[model samples]
Target chain A: MAELRKDYILDQYVIIAQERAKRPSQFSRSPPTPSSDKDCPLCPHNEHMIPGVLEQVGDGRGGWLMRAIPNKFAAVGQEGSAALSTHDPLFVHGLALGEHEVIIDTPHHDMEFEDLSVEHIERLLQFYAHRARVVESKPHVRYTALFKNRGEEAGASISHSHAQIIGLSVFPPAVARLFDRAYDYALRNESCPFCDVIRREKHSKRLIFINKTFVCIAPFASRFPFEAWILPLRHVPAMDKLRKEEFSDFAHMLRKVLRRLGTLGVPPYNLVFYNDERQGMFHFHVQVLPRLAKWAGFEHEVSVPINPVPPESASSFYREG
Target chain B: MAELRKDYILDQYVIIAQERAKRPSQFSRSPPTPSSDKDCPLCPHNEHMIPGVLEQVGDGRGGWLMRAIPNKFAAVGQEGSAALSTHDPLFVHGLALGEHEVIIDTPHHDMEFEDLSVEHIERLLQFYAHRARVVESKPHVRYTALFKNRGEEAGASISHSHAQIIGLSVFPPAVARLFDRAYDYALRNESCPFCDVIRREKHSKRLIFINKTFVCIAPFASRFPFEAWILPLRHVPAMDKLRKEEFSDFAHMLRKVLRRLGTLGVPPYNLVFYNDERQGMFHFHVQVLPRLAKWAGFEHEVSVPINPVPPESASSFYREG
Candidate 1:
């Protein structure tokens, strides 16, 4: 409702925004073929072409079943320190200090991650477990984040199904803040906030799905459109700590969630797993966010307050599936 | 590379990632257009059709220069104190209590934000000066964030060039950490970190343009490509504090940066203005980030290590312009 310009005291130069405007349609879509790489480099033969492989399981020398390799173009690699060396507190710089590994699921070139059998999930879990164990002990690594970024909008570069490991020398302030909030809930209510959500969503009957083990639901406050989360029925900190008995349902439920998104016409998405070193309540839950809508600049500045399609409205749509 | 399925794993039901697999590119490149009148309520004539319009400085009645309106779809709004109401020491959640107001840049339908005149920028500053004065007094509001979301990828919903003001009752932890770092820096160096950047970048050829009062540059470790920042030459704590004399450079530099981005073939981006209420030395600065990438799940779980066009590269590229 505001005019482009204010006839105020500071108008000594041209204020470009005063005349800038675009129609409603301009703010609604993205350019086709976004400027990004389309090459599939994680293929069995293509693997050697990417960043060099760090360690592998099955080269016949030892027939190892897994391999950890650096990301061809890494955001942050296995370097840097947690030392807050700069005296300028507002801006601190150091090596990213973490490991970025690409886990090739199989020699196969075209299978989808969700299509991987239960056996595949187990090996991946083991890989994550071993990686976590190794990185957790490193002098600076306070937390090791194990996640899979599946689509470009969700921040994936290579079109390969691989798990990424980032061993942080220092705790991410945002994650720590969230942990503090959840832990506070546990402390005050003697229950996990997420644990309560699992129960509430299940009993609410507005539920999406349920297996003997895992629970999937569109959160009451879905920050983005069609955001779904995978939580273990009960509280288990890390994927490594997942009980042998809980394996099948967890696998089934996780795949179903991803598959459901595919069915919903949502294409690109992201999966983030949180690990809490302090609580050991390092819940290895999975968060799948569908990029059904664009995240404009307003959110970067002021946390977004978007409400086109609410989560509840979107959940039932998914529930019918 | 690791196999999706390992031979020795006890259970095979885990959801494993199959690297080198096909990743479907699902996003539609065609810009999404608003379908009908129902689809676009932000149109100038239809704006009142949205939600709450707090205040205005228009033709006294309606044909106005500025009006603060509530977002129709808000991803982040006040949760009030009910959900996070305890004085718990372990976790934190106060009011998501924050203000969200959009500053419509122009009276025209197709004009973008960068088209405003120098006179317009000054008056807009005056209006913000008023809003800041009034909102800062509200209950629970600890800080105020003023920012603009440009293109759709930058998260603009209406294609209209506009900026927003958010007054938060509780500081989002991510911002608090910035202040913590700032304070830590102050304790060590006995001066403001932002001021230090100002001094350093000014002398450092990274400077894009600076009038007698304002200085703009691509920062030392920019997280995104083509990221530019406009900081007051002086160490002022907030934007409303600027004197009329500082207007010339502020307007000139801000426009130059936007024009440069357009020339770079990366016309879309987001501009964020971060402010901390509790700090004494952390001054306000507007960070103009090129909308060249998105934050995937890994970025949310772990702190980001943005690359593929480093800041130095971006700086060198922008400087040539």
Candidate 2:
């Protein structure tokens, strides 16, 4: 039997498939195979293989620590054909007119995020905010997405540690739905829904870690086991709005969470950033979802997930014995 | 470069990632390793392993040809704790109160849908409709989902040709969004949006097969490579409402489509049925989605797919020389 759980605030539903409950040991898969560095285009000395570098961060010894470059095979190029702007009743297409850039997090090819130091992670965060600002400034670009796919199972074709930033001509539907929900809640309750979540989560067993600047918790209706969320204590609108102190605190909390996930031998994870829809209508947060199970026909059709492990168990796991 | 395509009528969007376009050969993964028949619970004579048989179809000789049994590890069981009915400010949960059953399409362990005869397929459809009616009769069960996961990659753990019927207490969000769209379109145009889609698709190059009772086409905004849809020529509200003649025609069309897909070496696929939402406001259809690519972080966050192959190419492949 399963339990149909609803998110504390959002309209998201998760079917806790207790009947198919999976233990942590069941999630252990073979470690990712390391691709040879000689043939890797993202490697340090092979910079010439890429079209060109967009940005680079210094390691303070006249060496580059991280670099941003155009994805050799861009999903949406900066210079594509003009947008068709078709509004046909039966068939519609538009030029994927946007910038798709890759941010190589480290020069060391095999270094994952958890292996990076806090200072290095902070520099990476700075680069993300910088590129986000640049993309958000583009005309007709309504939304920008910054995400990371960690391992091969999570869709990383390259073995190198990197994240992607994609600019969109329209606000994404997923974020738009959340914006609408938050706006509706604010109109009725005169408060931010996520702020209320943080307050209430303090009393729940789902709280994983909390600090002065950030709080991490396995969400009430977690779609996946060990699915955790990190939110700022302050009512921030977007990642770019984080001040120096806030960024430092965020980096610390993020590193701690990733390290905890590593202890469980779960590294193939995805991280997505959600900012307000440029109107400060919703709170900014980061969702870390582990790709433990493959979705079948039922999950795709219903948009409701059937999670095996409950968030209560995940939270307790994060808080060690 | 990539292109962004919008669905003909729905508010869905897909980014056609041409740069990552994969040929059919790239999708040829290892077939599922069949579990031995002796241990397979869904196999004939092993029916005692299940909780209890709900329905069965007999061959002319009186032995069972097909059977319907309660899923041993049910996602949503009939006998669970009661519904929580709680609408908490920050925590909500409901009893996953519903029925889940498996319709074993064949007694053979290695049988696939494309290999089944038309008559056998018709029996499976009949069993689906029967179980659907039984579920709908239950109080609080708002909708029933009938879906098939055909291969391992498509999330089928067992190598048996079977389909699942899950009764949902609330209208799923995916369908709810479609219903809202259809209702809004009806209010504005005085017609169902899907009807207009069928009318317009006739003039396009995406049509794959058409008959007196059904039409199959690669959807305009296909989320996956080789994604196709089958709609009734006559406006039908629900699958259960499908008359005997229509059911036969559907089974024939479905058989042809699966055979066509098999020719392309596409073995893993997910099929979902869309009914009238029990509101009689939307047109009924079946969507056939091939599991060709793995959805990464960007897709999960934005609800915008990045399809490698466009629908035009898929349509041509289905209509091969």
Candidate 3:
């Protein structure tokens, strides 16, 4: 009973083993301990605190502006052997094997990601692409998840701005499901679902910002308030495929939208990158999710979200601001 | 763009409307507001604060021991017309037509659910069953979700002990997925997956408690730490089918397991009921999820949980404690 369990019906999986389980009291949410420059690990000149740096960008003053390194404490790593352990027909198991990398947004402890210069942000994106490619090339890694969690509510413990890229051994269930649906839809309709969404939302009220190569919109089925997606006008299945201009434009639009949210006083937010090397049916996209609500029992049990903000309102807000 | 949107890949739905959207600044988490008997709305003498009572259980006195009433603030309701709105191929919408009911566990405002007498717990369960059946009988309701949120982290705003039953026009995506999977399994193997799980887990290390009619276990794929399930030893698809003694035994086992978690200092938890009217393809059960961890980006993006606690540890902890 100490392994991953697949839902009998859905493609979802949960790790049920208690190898690192803590007593309940230990997991309680306590007031966040404030961080100062003296004690902050991600601060400049504190490389000793971090285990190692995988990559770094020069600040032009003989100091690093950004860096990427292995997570100090990772949920999964390549150290574990990847083995399947199935007990009975109902229980399925696999050794959690993957690499977790942290992309420090800036060496400056106080700089917000949205305020970073375009060139600095581009460098960060390059680091993400570089690390993702490296991890995805590993023998057991099947997918790479790139995401950023900001604020304590978003589960960020350190005050530093950073992003994470997890190289997962298995294809995440949500991605798998989306791929299957895309395949089925392509087979039946001879078109990509996401492309069609872009087309349908192009001139609509849900459009937040659109450029030559990218379009950002509040998704029709947004699960969170002010949730938005940045998608390429042209089909691209992977992040590495982005041309120079597309990458610059993507960073620009992303930062602009996030800055708008910042002006609106949005708290902890999450940005997840969804891309694949697979062709035709899939389209690469970035989702910007504002964490404004607490999901309770109804949502946890049923997987259905009751979003209070309409996409139209979010789009209008983003547009006006 | 203001409607429920079904996921293009998964069987998930999200309400994408601005009916009750709060400005980003309004959603910051604050310390819980303390409640006193004098000001509590759910207290015995404050029936006027509630809209209406659907069902009530007497304490053999003039006052009620438990009561079920329509939720004052409902996410979905019968007020909206029942209709599906499809906009283009990617965007889908639906009118949220449903009912929400709150089942007060006791007339006393200060009673803890786990500390309630066994007889009182049984009466509460009966009230849940009655309210669920009544709601399911409505013209538009296809399924009813019965759940309890204990403590603030679990999303309980009121200190009073109560459970919720939501009658929905549509079967929740998770429930729908479970049913489809169960049906497919039954069609292929001619057996119930849950029944098989019960058999496989019986007398195993995952078992916490077992009576002649029910068996409680820490699920192999627990999404939460100390998560447990109470399944009937005999195959039963609906909660209402239980006999008097079986119902009492179910309450006994549920209370015992929850009390064990309480002793271990586990805070805020949720209990969800999974039952169906469909024959052969379903088996009813209750899941007790201890909210020991906050779900973050990876979980939000992939819907896969990295549970740290093993079911064996949880089962043993409950048994020994």
Candidate 4:
């Protein structure tokens, strides 16, 4: 082989991984769909079985506020669940190990974030804020990540109008990176990188949307095609931190970003919240990935993506809107 | 809105971002293509631009081997090269940031990783090892990430067979996480967690591939759908630390892994390397990913993925070979 090896930061040397973590942190495997046309628990008639369904605007019955319930197939083990092994970090031999929940935002089954009204979105934001606070307080929960998958391309299997939250004692390897950086950044920069990002997007150009309390824009360096960021113009760390008055603007900006993507003709989408608000190195930013393009080796290996449609272009489109 | 603020790690909240930095990185603010075309750098270009394309057999010409080069359009900026910037970090106003370099493998232009030969795959491995050493030697380089993107859906602009190496002064936020865990794991266990993983995978029934020098399998706790790990049966810590005799066996194992994938069906894929061979957190390993899926927020936001297909099933499919 080239008698070659990789160089580590500590000046140590070892054989380069001919690939990335040949381990399982990759997120792109899909199971085959069952032929049976079973009723999806989150679907129509099964509504009552869920925690509760809310209607705000147009739920066919009325506008749906949002639905909160115990996720049927939660990744995290549920209350009284007993199939998992012990939660030992030293010995990671256990069930997937954590809590998984589904938050059905709308009952229509076909409606997406882009289709939600401003009022609906505002109510959804309220739910997100409330749930985040509640989830984070749960005992044994070290990290709470809330997210959504929009189309089949984006890995959405249920195809329901909803978001999900996960509470875990152990932070996955991915989140650990952010925590490390945020700690370091805070030590060095004396502030959060994301907070700084919010400021720059506010006073500067590239402003996609600016409501009373939120600003949306295409990031300076988007790693994907037509990627965007929705930040609280006021610089709140977590999605749960928005004020009651600010929730409307934050939700408004989120919808604005999604609506703009609809106009952009992107396919499925995924949203990730880097819960590390940044003691300094961390940026409390929401990476809104429009499924406009696929990610292959270069991206997975290097942790950087070659976004063809630069973020600025998307920002400009938002400016027009 | 719920008077409930989401709490993230690091005490640094959103308030600081409002005052300091707020500018989105930077972009050309242009949209070049909204459609796909066949003429892409990522496409197989056997005789067109590639002169000495490596091959697996057929007098080293027919079966395509691995190839690499400087990316025509890199995402991260290059040092001393003017990248879009108007700020400072450690006295430098703008970093020579942005990713660079591109590695093309497979010459069929129409062929993907599944179509390449085993030795051809080995040559690709040889290339990665060499590049890691080369990039690490560069001055001002803080981190070098090696990754691949297979299909257009995977964020690849070019259709040619290729991988890339992006050198960064600021180690990407994702990678830093491994180092932290390694440190903590080492401190707690008095050894490396990867070492623990190696020992555990070996002892457990979860093990997949085991040669005289390497072990490949689905991790006991995989966070993604088909995430797989390729590790040396033994641990030397960093990539450059690999001994002389182990190269060929390592190469053979890597080749075998890909060769078996062809049996799984032609799927888009990516090969990512953590270069975690640092004293602080270097754990030499390769991540082989069949670009078969997408990150639907759960893996990103929740640190968990609903991996419906267990590793045992995936292993059984490829293990026979």
Q: For this target, which candidate reaches the highest TM-score against the unseen true structure?
A: 2
Ranking by TM-score: 2, 3, 1, 4
Q: Write the per-residue lDDT of candidate 2 for residues A1-321, one digit (tens) a residue.
A: 578887765667889988788766676666666678897788888878899988898778988988889877777867655556666654677778787889999988878887899988887887888887887888867788889998866777887889998888867777787788888888889988899898888678999988888888899899977899999888888888888887888888888888877766646889998866379767889999888777888988887888888888888877772
Model 4: lDDT of residue A145: 81
Query: By DockQ, is 2 or 4 better?
Result: 2
On residues A1-321, what C-alpha lDDT tens digit does candidate 3 reach at each position? 112222222333222212323332232343344467787778877879888988888878898877888887666656665654444346555556677789898988877899898887877777777777887888888778888988767767677889988777767666787778777776777887778778888888999999989999987666776789999898888788888898888888888998888775436788888868645357888888887656678777776665656666778878887
Enumerate the candidates' DockQ scores in order: 0.20, 0.69, 0.19, 0.19
Query: lDDT per model, in order?
Result: 0.60, 0.81, 0.73, 0.56
Residues A216-309, candidate 4: write the lDDT tens digits.
7766555445567777655556766667878777677777777766654435788876554223234455778766556566545544444445
Q: Write the per-residue lDDT of candidate 1 for residues A17-129, one digit (tens) a residue.
A: 11122322322334224332235676655555876777666747644445677766544445444454455433445555555566776555455567678776666666766
Deviation of model 4 at A152, angstroms: 2.0
lDDT of 2 by residue, B58-97 (tens): 8879788888888888888676555666756556787787
Interface RMSD of each: 15.8, 1.6, 15.9, 13.4
- Model 3 alpha-carbon miss at residue B268, Å: 1.4
Model 3 chain B, TM?
Answer: 0.87
The candidate with the higher lDDT, 3 or 4, is: 3
Clash count, one per candidate: 63, 0, 5, 92
Q: Write the per-residue lDDT of candidate 4 for residues B23-117, one digit (tens) a residue.
A: 21111123223333255544443246433332222336554345555654444445464332324331122333534566666545666554566
- TM-score, prediction 3: 0.87
Instruction: Find the candidate with the highest DockQ and give its number.
Output: 2
Please give the lDDT score at residue B159 for candidate 4.
Answer: 61
